[model samples]
Target: MADSLGIRVFFIKGPASVLQGLRQAKLSADVDVFVDPARLDELLQALRERGWHDRPVDPDSRTFPKHSVTVHHSEWPCCIDVHFRFPGMEKPPRVCFESLWVNTETIALAGQQMRIPARELGVLFLALHALREPLLPACRQELDYLGELARREGLSEGLLGLAGTTDALAAVRPFLEDLLPKTTSFVWPEASVEWRNRVASHEPGSARVLAILHATWRVKPRMLWGALFPPPEVFLGTNIYADMSMAGRLRQHRARWARFLRAMPRLVRDLRGLKSSGD
Candidate 1:
């Protein structure tokens, strides 16, 4: 219906709910479909053709598409999200290769790709768009994804190395600290044990790289929200806003972002020194 109508092609979220929408609606051979510029009308017609126009936006309200749409079905865990472009997202902006996507260094559940720290900085780059416009769903999702990575990865030295900019660390701190450990043991045991020990011993102070760890230890949520959620539009949403129970997680994200930045210049210098010494 969308391609026949001559609309632009956009990728959907590929969640299960979206999948059911495709099957129950009897969409088409292409799992991915193009929608016409007259998307609103076509969507309605598609819903009617499926005899599901009366379905609720989401059978479960919690699963609503951040917006209301007429065709609602049982909470399809995996739903296909169609958009004209990455929709409100900026970095992966080129329209040419729509299906091509890169993976980052995080864990993914089911079919959803996890945005790993460092490996896929493009997601982080896409974040600048959210920083520019706070309310966007993509921006919110990206931040949440980053926060989850920082939590599971434990501000690993390698992860910090990946962020590569002190400013970027500060900008992204709120999301990072959301999962930081209260005590040192909570840190990942998998990475460098020696580095983890070093971070544990270091008191919150300056000059020593320990200062970076210290800053992270002492981060507060308010500080993080102040940095990441800057105002112009005063963005608010059920999904983007951290749930009340999990509200304190953003604190360490600042330091993680900072540590990454701090390490970047040193990393460059060290690489240069290695090359010269090697030469």
Candidate 2:
């Protein structure tokens, strides 16, 4: 129905809805519907008329206006999240949102305009999801997918471009260091001192840097779980070499995969135990 109606849409999944519609519409025919954030209240009060506030929200949470509906509008019974803001740990400012409009690079997805430095968008999904506690499996899957894509295609040098601006490099240092170890294959194949310095200069919380990290790391399912609800003192300080061996080959890409094959049953049983224990 959205495609037929030529409605621009993005789906979010969570406990609340985010936006009702864009205040600024380029086309008069476009009717951007917001998922009622207080869907329960809206339904109950539908019998008694009242107003619902359609405002922006933190992009990564269900606490926005995009998550109120349980029905699939265009297809079979399902849920979808429509978003105008880039999803992140914190709500991005309105000015940052302008990046999606004029003077921004554009990509077409499902026949809608998606903002560019596309790798950065992919990274945002990975990092924000990683920040969530009691991490959801879906988030991990998304990160894994992004990682694979990054491996196949290189990421934009958003961080590199930010090197001298706003103490940008210094801000995301820890995140860079954290990512440096795990993503060397994808990110560091041709890394030089300048490149490393450029990365190291970033602020820890820079979403751009985090995006680069997510693009480089090949996260296993177990590692995904570990990242979501990590055990104390496990893989602390970015053990990038853990994925490597004494000979500097990716353990999984080498003969170590055979060893892992032998260990698979035990690993599977241990994973089952973890699930049983609710870990």
Candidate 3:
């Protein structure tokens, strides 16, 4: 549908992982499309006209910055995540889109053709996605898999260059440090504060806290309110609250605060270490 509108879009993440032979299709996976930011508003309006509407999002989700807007049709089994900027691609949205589009490749999907990032960029996409939650066991497993794949593909230089282009060299520095140890230490960029904080602190519900700290004055109040009293959708549905009872939710919230407090000393120390190294 987007393609027919002359919108430049390509499927990524789950769908691309399947096509790139990196992973098998999962039953619950949705269609994740990266759209040109310039046309995002137009595509969104078109989607609404075609019976696709923005899905309900929890107040907790609004606390943090959003990279994509989700829309779904009642007739469809899965939602379509329309992304304007992929996380970890800290560079400008259009720049990232153009960089990936340069190496775009076509593959057959359910008879019709579809666009996806090239093998190298596809692997990069997965790597960036994993680094967003580096502490998660599942994400760690995926990173391990991709590391081996990167080695097999001899993607050392290509990955490094793409990381630089996408402003991700700092975030993926640790991953590349071992994978491409042969590369000079001087070339690795310093990690950003956002990357360090997110990767270092993985406790559930901590993001809401960080969101308030990170928000500018203009948005801080909203972030604070959302953090304190997120909707039931967040309290009940999120991993932070395994049980939805009031007591259970309070316990989880306390646990999250404890974890965040514990992680802070290490996280701050790590950031200081990065800065000391000339970050």
Best by lDDT: 3
**Tens-digit lDDT track of model 3 for 1-279:** 777899999888775577687754555457889899999999999999999977756755444456888887889977888999876778889888888788788988878788888888888888888888877888898889888888887987898888888898888776776678664765666665566556655554555655566668998887777666655556443342268788877887787567667777665665566458654
Task: Rank candidates by lDDT, best first.
Answer: 3, 1, 2
lDDT string for model 2 (4-121, tens) is 3343333322211111111112222222222223233443234123332222222322112232322222322322223333222222324333332222234454466543333343
lDDT of 1 at 171: 38
For model 1, what is the error of residue 31's alpha carbon versus the real structure, in angstroms, after optimal superposition? Answer: 10
lDDT score of model 1? 0.35
Off by over 4 Å in 1: 15-38, 57-279
Model 1 lDDT tens row, 83-109:
333222221223212222232233443
Using all chains and alpha carbons, the TM-scores for the candidates as numbered come to: 0.24, 0.30, 0.79
| Candidate lDDT (C-alpha), each | 0.35, 0.33, 0.75
10 residues in a row with least lDDT, candidate 3: 232-241
Point out the higher-scoring one by TM-score: 2 or 3. 3
For all predictions, the C-alpha RMSD in Å is 18.5, 18.3, 4.6
Question: Model 3 TM-score?
Answer: 0.79
Overall local distance difference test of candidate 3: 0.75
CA-RMSD of model 3: 4.6
